[model samples]
Target: MADRGAGTMSLPDDWPDHANAILALNRMGSFDWDLDAGLMVMDAQAHAIFDILPEEYDDRPETLAVRVPPNEARRLDATVSQALKDGSENYGAYFRIRRRDGTQQWTHTQGYIRRDETGRPRRIIGVVRDATQELADIATRRERLEQDTALREQTNVVQLTTAALAHARTVQDVIDVLKDTHGLTHLGATSLVMGLVEAGRVRLIAEGPAGSFVAGTDVTGIDEPYPMNEVVRTLSPRFIESPEEFAAGYPILWPHITDLRITSAAYLPLIVQARPIGAMGLLYNDRRGFTAEERNILVALGSSIAQSLQRAMFYEQEKDIAQGLQQAMLPRTIPSVRGADVAVRYRAAAIGGSQGRDIGGDWYDLIPLPGGRVGAVIGDVQGHDTHAAAVMGQLRIVLRAYAAEGHTPATVMARASVFLHELDTDRFATCLYAEADLATGVVQVVRAGHIDPLLRHADRSCRRIPVPGGLPLGLSAEFGSLEYPVSTVELDPGHTLLLCTDGLVEMPGSDLDDGMRTLTALIASGPEDVRRLADMLIDLAEERGGDDDVALLLLHRRGLDAPVGGGRLQQHVAPGDPEALHEARHMVRAAVHTWGARDRADEIELIADELITNALMHTEGAAIVTLRALAGGRRLRVEVEDSSSALPRRREAGESGVSGRGLLLVDLLTDDWGVEARGGGKCVWCEFDVPESDRRRPNRRR
Candidate 1:
């Protein structure tokens, strides 16, 4: 072989016979391009295929730009460069080239790379051929099949959009689904614009892909020239295929969005039941037109969106009403109780769960009772509807009345049960009532088929107090078992009592005891402030997302000037009951010693016994004796209340007698003494000052 000319190479001696004839017969021409020399050698047939004469084309590859369009040449260069960089041996591509008459025709090319020993491409040998007729023939054969495939794909997009819209419960939810990346964005829309028809105006509710909003298009009149407005007013879709048409039709909007380079857009009216509710627009920057299939898909999706929006509107409207009713039924403000910190919270259940009621029967109330007592109530009606809420309101009112009327905890619960049973509806309710005397640190709890309450000690340790219970409010009266047992919990200063409906103590598939243990642990680790602890618990319930509503009440006894390590014990002493008197004496002695008053135990016990004896002797009824440790265990107080209103007076005792020496002994051995009118009776109380060092005594005494 020899180099015959600058752009030619002579055939080799070992070349196969008729090789040139074979290539010519197939209308293929060959060329060789040198990477280092920047030269391309083409045969006569190759020159003809490129619509250039042998003399017109120089050996430089750039000369081919006369026949190849700039876009096509760049595309080809990219294909070849990628193949060379990726270590590919060959590359092929179809591109359009301008013919001699300035008409473009499809051309196909195949090239093989020749690399040096180091894998650096040095040359490329390829063949080019005319592919215009071949492509035209294939397009004719597959046109119908392609159309059907496109239609199916468009229809599938509609189905997917509708399925996603099915879960939209609110207007914002529908907007989210539409704007999601895997949603309508998958259809290659560069921007989405949506508007609702409100009061004869098109209100733009959503428009995105950041910075796509036009300033004055937020709210447009129905007669405005905006595309969305046009579609909504006409109840028909408007497809803008070109920027010129858009600018001509919407001159006001086009000037504002000129920088977006939008080439086409489809604005569809949101129609349901033959009425237009809104409009949506899908804007595209890369395409110039929409096919019939695409138009149909967008219209169908618009219909689905319209229905979803209507449903969401109705849902929100109903929810507002239900929430208003529930709020009206619940207590507007919790009455402040002295000597205690109180917090109450209510959380509605998650919608679309087991019972998708946005308004529930859960409720909480705080009632200020007489004599420095506060009543805390938590209850839940059987159902999760307005009926349940109505019943709960009535029950709450009656329960508050009973508690404020000085009824005992058990009686309050029993009366509430009877009231519920007498209601016209057949609903049952679980209730827990606690009457707490903050001054005395005693809480009387009554439970009727309700979860046990939690007690948080001053040390932050928490435990469940299992108060005995009767049936639910309505069921108890029906079954003739209205006895709600009273459980007394002695709360020290800084101690808190937690009352809540079972929703806070019941998880799916878990035992009630297990849930209680979890709640106890949570409370133990919670903040000491009652308000913060209540917020934390309610937040937990919100995160758990259960089907039942929750009602919580937290009452923390304030530590204002309260003695530390104080305790109270009460016992009844009957006039003629020897056993009652013995029990009262034993209780007084034990409490006095245990309260770090061991040095004065004898005097305190003697004072308490003499007071009890005087009350029994002077009064016609039993006496109530109460022993309390006060002043941070620095003092012990003894109280004996009798049915008679006679106040005890200091009297002298006979030298050898015991009958008149009770008050005299109480006066001599006590640091202070007083008598107060208690209802129809009088209470004689005495205090004994004990040294703080006595608290360090051994656990047992001789």
Candidate 2:
């Protein structure tokens, strides 16, 4: 190089090496200060450090002080004075200096103070290295670790909140679980409030700390704009870091902000499936700047929170309507038959694609036929919609009417099939009708294209019974005349018969034959009690991949091995035959006195008379009465059967004529009187249990 600058030490001929060395390391610049003159001489490197040119450099202490900020200048003076006072040979300090490029640079200088023979400082020489890049790299690494830790903490908070939300049942449950979750505070949330959008209004779901919110407060209208509305409208998170910003964006919430002493806050919008369901708000006592990563985490948490809240609200609303419809249409208790143990189960699916909570149109009915026989029927409409459910209810009424008209199983099935075909419904239904003669151990089955009934033999072997029948109800009209043929099977005591809809044996992505085999195995290896068996089947129907509703009916025949009780009495009285009343009276007297229930003899006799009389006069078929003794002769029960499904109401006693008081008489003369739906009709039955004192009397007629 030509003339390597004046007032500098002479370097080797290869000046490029020296320049490369300075460039590789931090640029080291030198300065000299004269103790007597109070001035400095800066090198070109030092001038570059100050973002200055050689022409702009000045050798004056005041000039250097002007470049150094007040704080750093004071630091410089203190360091140099202490070094001189302590008689130290060296002084060093790190400070910031203002540059001509409008940037501040971190600089560190170390100097040696030389003294003369009089013990006074003569001159000072120092070097300054710009540590800006190195220091910035160190700071960046530290901040990254902190951010990593915070992100982990935020992820943990989300996991904890998600676990708590699973068991939440309502919007309030969402708030309660969140309040109990302490991870939010760890994520810098001093306080939190959850709000839900409902009916065009913002309803406060819950707030932490006992008295944070008023009960049932709807923040619907406000005099000034609020940041919460901005979040909901934009579906974006907002971070307000100061009181002025909070007041400016949420003027309506200023009072609450003042009460909370809030200096900063965050509003994260809860969006689910691109729909804004609500928002979560976090409050802080100090202004905090949110990093991009932190805001991103909060946005994800908002989505999760919104998903859980929406799921809960939908479940609650759907269940209410389903339960109401089920209660109104279904029979409460299974009728007590004389020779068969009967059980029924119904399962409604809560989730079906597009069809939320509408229960499928699957129903089973028990009808008490003439001659001590029971008529059982189970049917299912083709679809699982509200329209299908309504159609099912109407079809139940028609089936009951036709069966009670003294028709055979085939006739009843044919009429019901024709009725549905003539109706205005767009769906079809499948049905299986069976007349079970408990007295004769004989069952007659008429199928209308429904699933075949399962017959489990007393020897523990199971098989499906085939029935030659016509098309499913509505389809019979479309295809041809109802060609239903009755099939008969005798239950040799200890045998079980099962009837169900297709839902019980259908699984996603599985063959129907496979489900049938599985069900057969379940039935053969299961318990004998009808109720327990029904429970197991219901569990199977609700397992994963089972998306349809199920309706099941089980009828079992008691073998002679069944434990013997006191004697039983049963009779059949043909309709419009007055002479059958005398026979019924004789049967009741023998049943009551045989069981030693003489005290309620007159009361039970009158109760049976009214029930049979009403049935014979209004109903088309016979009125049969049965008396059975239960609990070792301590309780006497009477059942008067009719071929009418219409239940008689307890009305005011007739003023003049001897009519309309049948139900009232039964109600007043018996311990219990109610109409049970069975055998395509109703059973008006009464039970007279002996009092504690009377149960011990030995054959007394008191």
Candidate 3:
């Protein structure tokens, strides 16, 4: 054992035991320093810390300091000095030292300083231990903290993006959100390209970043289809990781895509009802790879977008078909009455907005009566869409039949009301039926829960015709009691009768009185003809209350002598028995020759004979035929009237039906042939092309 300074206590001979015990228990070593003698002492465990033998120590503090690494020596000296200067009893610091074997070790040194009575440092004693494990542990904790922070930030971004996508209203909106977010993070552009399958075309409805691809360039002529086309065709999704692969697989899009600098893309099919309507292509500007989570999010968003687009398309198609069917159900042309000029006008709703299928229960008709009288009707069913149109058609036919059978306006409406109530057609309807006797200028009207018709006399004053009775048709068993009163008014020359549907009176932002006022003002404007009046009334309604579908019919009674036979007639012919055909041919030839139509007499005679004879044989009744030469050289019309009211249906040639062959013949021979209803019967009519040369001939009455 070495002798130490006065303040240092000499270690016992058994010090090794304590030293060894400390080393085994805590992997630590012990050391001491003598300030006065400048001597240092270390246990065998301390020697082991530096990989040096305990016998190598010279028992001198200066010698030990010389053995310490230069950097560690300075650090230890500074700590010891600080403790002594502060007159502290203990001090500690961590330092790095090199072992004899040239390995570095981190260590902590703690010391106790002995002070004189005045609290000045005299000597110092301490122990040093290896701390490499603690340092390593701290480093690991710092790395873990950094990793966790990054993961949390990514999760927050994903959650925000998902919420944004979920709330998007349209596919375009969803694509926009995705494109914007993706561009913010990835510094790339995005685009949504759609392929319309039915049209065999592609369109880009929404494009992000550049937004220049929104109109879509045609890639249909490409040799191979794009992945989006395949996805739609196969009902699957595809991801293209490389531009080269895309160009190889879809050569047509290669030129366009190469210019776009799209390095990565995804193609998703937009499917509805198990059928593909189109494909959505998501393009990225740089080569990119999607993780499983990101791909899942995109797929879900694609499906949602597809469903929304499909819903919008279905709504549009349904509206279009309904509107088309409704228009087809309406009468194409008003029947020309001998003693009255008639006109009608119908307008459809604008496209794409919520005003779907402008078809409603509104309807109108003009029926020619005995003694140059004309019957005009305007009515509304209780609903809209196809059901209403069907109901209106039924009412129209029934009322026309009743009027042609000579029923008075009141009696006609009474019977119609009862028929409607008892009829199995599960619909309720309203109507205003009126009959104008042109010879006496007496107008008779009946209203069945319908708006009263307006009358504008030659004095330019307007009034609602008084027909105050009846409930809407199909409402009750006692509908006959609700029969409208027959109101009669003597017509003055040049007076006009205007019949309209509720769509006219029930315009938006206006009450019944306001509508009446508007309509009366319109009538006072004094249009030139019934056609002009009908058009103006509908226009006025639209200006005031365009929320509904409008239907109007106007009638102006003309003097009995006003150009009675001014319009021309057209004739169509079919195959029939030779004898009847020949007799009809002779009549046609004689009529045409009498009218000095020598140039077309032969063609007209042949066409008329075939048409009349075919009507007589196949129409199942006595056929009444009439011929008229049209004005303005427009057409020559021939009408063969039959008692049978069953409409002539067109059929294929060689069919079992007896009428099939005749229609084929007519179609081959005539420019056009149509069947219309006459009073209590049907008329199969045809038109023939009259040459300009034949029209130039002078009229020579027979």
Candidate 4:
């Protein structure tokens, strides 16, 4: 090549063959711009690269400019101007050109700037190469990389969420963990909502952001047009990418969406083990589409969420069962009698400040015993789960059985300890038992590794009874029946007796002693209303939120009235002896005459004879008779305590033999007569309504 004209290259005629052969190898050719001549020339290959005929050979700048897209032409012009100004030897740019055939091609065009001695441009020369294939290849690779990256990210999210969901025991627990770093962060979920199919409706039990249909709101049937209900019915996933779509898809929910500011939302059925349990939902603040991968991830999580929701429901139902079983094992009501008022409170254990799930094994009982005596017991088994509650239930039945057998408090606990130990439950229980005699104002306590009793006297002074306690039942016991030491304390008139499980007093950062002191002080200055006092004590104990279940028994000794020379006497009679009946009658008559109630002596004697006779007949051991003048001698009570566990019940004597009518006769003779259980025995007792009273007499102990 040589310059035959001003600043232009001239090629030999043979150069065409070599240039065309090289251009064929690389889809490239050469072009020249002769600025001084104001002419442009293209090689044969350049003409073919532009997809033009040979007649297009007289190349002016406009000739190539016509093929360049406007945007590419401007960009090329800028690059050329910069190159010329910078006086660069060569510079290259890539741009798109539309061929004469109306097809676009990407060309990599590089040009050289030739300057004269005065640094002025003479001619421009450049090479044009087709780059369309290269550009398409790069784009293909980029798209493939993006897909792989998306797949990896989704896999990571699924792995992390599955691990987290494994530890979630409840639906709420699962929901709470999803917002942690790796979870909802990738989900882009502004709100997480859970819907359960309850009673033929989709109910939102829990939600996030506290919006988008209130928590616990119900979505009705498929005809309702709620996305949640639709998902539940169809067992499929719903995607509303825009508010308009949502409005169209769920016309009934359009206003709700607007009110909730839900730009986009999704509803997916919560299917567990291939069964549709409910629907789960998510809400977003921006209108967005769920990626195929993202929607798949949510669908996978659907199973886990459904399982967790079912688990939470099962947990609650089990808690109900445990609590119901625990309560059913205890007394439903206690006696309301002349000398005492009783009340009880029982609460299961709490977990994380929520009251349910873990049922504490605690129990309380107020049993009516022989001789107008009432027996009270409170106990607790270790732990706060179903097993503990079951053991607590069994142990409660054992305690009641023992207490009803006419055993003393110590005797009952001893027998209970042996029973639990021999049963091999591998558990332990702390128990307190007390029998209070209303007539004498005496309370006998038996403790087995239990909290001490709180006694608040008439002066409002409170003290914990110092009873020696034995080991907790079900651990190693003494060779025989495990007997705890009996401690006696007089609960006089106007005194309050408090017995409770450890949960009442024990709290975090506080031990049994600290809790006892706090409880004692709280009850000491509290009101005398048995119900009120029970509530106050529990409220105070629950103030710090204990971890254990609590059972509290409260009894206030009724204030005694002034006795008007009425007598109080108890006689012990021998077993298998008819003389026991005679002795009982004599004692009743003597008390009736002494109390100026001789007008009722015959009735009193008759009732006393029946009670003692029943007791003696029903027992092989001795019978103890107690006669008391109550309500200012307007009420006479004759109680017979026997050493037999057999409780005498009134039945149809049926004209067979004599003596089946003993309780019947007493029931008719006395205002009231009922049987009370005692240690190893039971008592058949009767009360007589005294006909007369003198109100002006001095007050005395009956």
Using lDDT as the measure, the top candidate is 1
| Candidate 3 structure quality by residue, lDDT tens digits, 546-660 | 6467778887766544323333233333345455455556667766765556766655666666667656766655565666654334355677777667877666755456545
In the range 104-191, model 2's lDDT, one tens digit per residue, is 9888888888788876877777777888887798899989988798789888888888877876665666677676746567677778
Q: Single out the weakest 10-residue window by summed lDDT for candidate 2.
A: 1-10
Better candidate by lDDT, 2 or 4: 2
Clashing residue pairs, candidate 2? 366-679, 367-678, 367-679, 367-680, 368-678, 368-679, 368-680
Q: Could you give me the TM-score of model 4 versus the true structure? A: 0.64
- TM-scores of the models, in the order given: 0.67, 0.54, 0.51, 0.64
Best by TM-score: 1
lDDT of 3 at 611: 60
Local error of candidate 4 at residue 612 (angstroms): 9.6
Q: Total backbone clashes of model 2?
A: 7
Which portions of model 2 miss their true places by more than 4 Å?
1-7, 10-280, 283-319, 352-355, 560-702
**Model 3 stretches astray by more than 4 angstroms:** 1-191, 199-224, 241-245, 257-264, 283-294, 338-341, 348-358, 457-463, 476-482, 490-494, 522-547, 557-702
Count of residue pairs whose backbone atoms collide, per candidate: 0, 7, 13, 14
- The superposed Cα distance between candidate 3 and the true structure at residue 363, in angstroms, equals 1.3
**For candidate 2, what's the RMSD?**
13.0
Q: For candidate 2, what is the lDDT?
A: 0.75
